[model samples]
Target: MSNTAGRIEPAITDIEQLKDHPAMARLLSWKRDAITEAKFDRDELTITIDRAFIRDACNILKPEFNFLSDVTSVDWLPSEPRFQVTYHLLSHKLKERVRLRVMLPGGQPTVESIISVWPAANFFEREIHDLMGIRFIGHPNMTRILMPDDWEGHPLRKDYPVEGYR
Candidate 1:
C-alpha cells in the first residue's frame, strides 16, 4: 500500500498509448462481444464485461497485467444485476493498472472464480462470497472467510439490517 520507495515510473502514461498495444488491441476486439462498457478517468481504466467472459478477458490481459491487487463486490439493491464484482489488476512491467467488473443478478448472484487465473484470488473471492453472498463458481474452497458458517444472510447486502443481527 505504501509507495514509499519513490514515485513509481509510470508505464503507458497516456491512456491513448494503449491503442496500439497488442494486448489492448485484443481486449478492444471483444468490446462488442464481451465488454459492455469502458471508462477511463485520470490514468486508470475500468471495463465492464459479461460475467461469462471474465476468464477470457483475464487471459487476454494476463500478458500486460501480472498482478491482481484486489477483488471485491458492490451490492446495488434495486439494480437489474444487483451485484457488481470487481477485479483490480496491476502490471509490474507495464507499471499500469486496470479494473474489470462483472454484474450478476440479485437472485443467487454467481460468477466464475478467478483463482485459476491468479491464485491470490482465493482469499479475496472467499471474502466477497462471505460478505456479499456473491457465489464464486469453481473456487477451490468456497467457505465463508469472515462471517460464521451459520450466519443467516450476507451482511454487506444493501438490505441487511443496520442493527446487529439478533
Candidate 2:
C-alpha cells in the first residue's frame, strides 16, 4: 500500500526476534523475589525489585547492558514502603529498555550509589539523596544538590507534614 524504491510495495515488518537472553532470565528471576506484579511491553520491561536487590542489580545492568538513564525517587505515603525509587535504563544501539524500581520503608532507607557505573548519575543521585533523604552510600560527592546542605529533613518524605496540613 506504499511506494517502494521503484514500485508500489507493502510495509515490511521490523520485529526483531528475541531468544533466551540470559540477562532477561536473570532479571526475571530477580523480579520474582520482590515484585508483587510485573508486565512487559513490546519495547520496555518494568520490574519492581526488592530493596536488597537494588544495588546488586544496577551493578549488573549498567555494565552488562550499557544502561544509562535517569534515576529518581517518589514518596508514596500510606504505602507499606514509604518511598519508591525508579531507574530508567535504555540502550539506543540495541533498541531495548529496562525500568527497575525499589521500595524503601520510612524508618531507614538507603541504596548504594551507581556513580561508579554511570558517571552522569553522580549529580542525579545526590539530588535524590538531598531532596528525598534516601541515603546513597559510597557516593563520591554526596552533597546537597537542590536543598541546603544543612536542611533538617527530606522535603519529599511523606511524614514531613506541611505547617497547616494536619
Candidate 3:
C-alpha cells in the first residue's frame, strides 16, 4: 500500500519480508542511532528503539500499521533500563503483525504515549502505567486503571513482593 508520502511501500507479510520493505527502511533510517537492537524471532519482528524517540518511531509506523493491538511493559529489574514498553501493531492489508519496543530507564520509568497515533492506546497505556509504573507522557488520562488510586508501587515490577507489598 501507499504511505503518507504517496510512495508505494512493500506489503510486509512476515518478519523476513519486513527487512526489505520500504516502510521498514524508512523507520530504520529515522531511528538508526536510537535503535540498540532488532530481532525477528518466533515469527514476530521486534525492534527496540530508544525511549526518547518512541513518539517519532511510532508515528512513522502508524501510517502503515493502522491497528495497535496491544501495549504492555516488561520489567527487567536489576538492569539499567529496567522497563521495556512494547507496542503490538497489525496491518490488515498486509496481514502482518510487528512489535515496537522502547526501553525506559528504571530511574525515570517514562516514555511518550502513542495515544495520539492510536486513540485505542488510551486504555492500554493506562494499564501499563498502572501495573508497571511506566509513565506515558501526554496520555489524556494517565491514572491507575487496574489498581487503587492509593496503590504504593507498581505490581508488575520484579521488586514488588509476590504476596503484594504491604
Candidate 4:
C-alpha cells in the first residue's frame, strides 16, 4: 500500500486561539446541555455533545469557524456511561484546532452525521460506525469503512474481547 492514506492533520496548538469565537458561546448557551469538559492535557477545549446538539454544533464549527478538518470516534465501553466519540477539527485559515466529544450512553449511542457539512467526514463517520457502533444519522454510506461488514462486534469497544491468536 502507498504511504499517503490518512487525512491531513494540522498542528494541535495552532487552534489555541479558536476559543475566542462567538460560536463557542452559542454552543455553551444551548440550554447548557452541551458537555464542555477539560481535556486531560489541560490546554485543550474538548466540547462534548449531548447527542441533541451534535449536528448544530458541527454546523456552527464548519461554515462559521472554518474548522472542517476531520471527524472520528472512540469506544469507551465498560466505563460508566459508555463511549466517548470525538471529532478533531482544524482551520488552516485561522490556524486553530478544536476537538468535540460526544458521550453515548450504553444503550443508544448514536449521533447525527456531519457529512452534509463536510464531505470528508463520510469515510471517517463510517469508520466510527464500523469500529465503535456509534451510528451517524444521515450518513449517505454509513457502512463499515475499515473492518469487514459482517464483523461480529465493534472491536474498539473496551468490553470486546481480544483474540488469543494473531
In terms of TM-score, how similar is model 1 to the real structure?
A: 0.83
Query: TM-scores of the models, in the given order?
Result: 0.83, 0.71, 0.83, 0.74
Model 3 lDDT per residue over 57-84, tens place:
8788877787889999899889977888
Q: After superposition, how far is residue 157 of candidate 3 from its true place, in Å?
A: 0.6
- Please give the lDDT score for candidate 1: 0.82
Off by over 4 Å in 2: 1-23, 26-37, 41-43, 160-166
- What overall lDDT goes with each candidate model? 0.82, 0.70, 0.80, 0.69
Highest lDDT, which number? 1
Per-residue CA lDDT of model 4 for 104-139, tens digit only, reads 788867788877777888888888788778888888
Candidate 4 to truth, TM: 0.74
Q: Which 10 successive residues of model 3 have the least lDDT summed?
A: 7-16
C-alpha RMSD (angstroms) for model 4: 8.0
Query: Which has the higher TM-score value, candidate number 2 or candidate number 4?
Result: 4
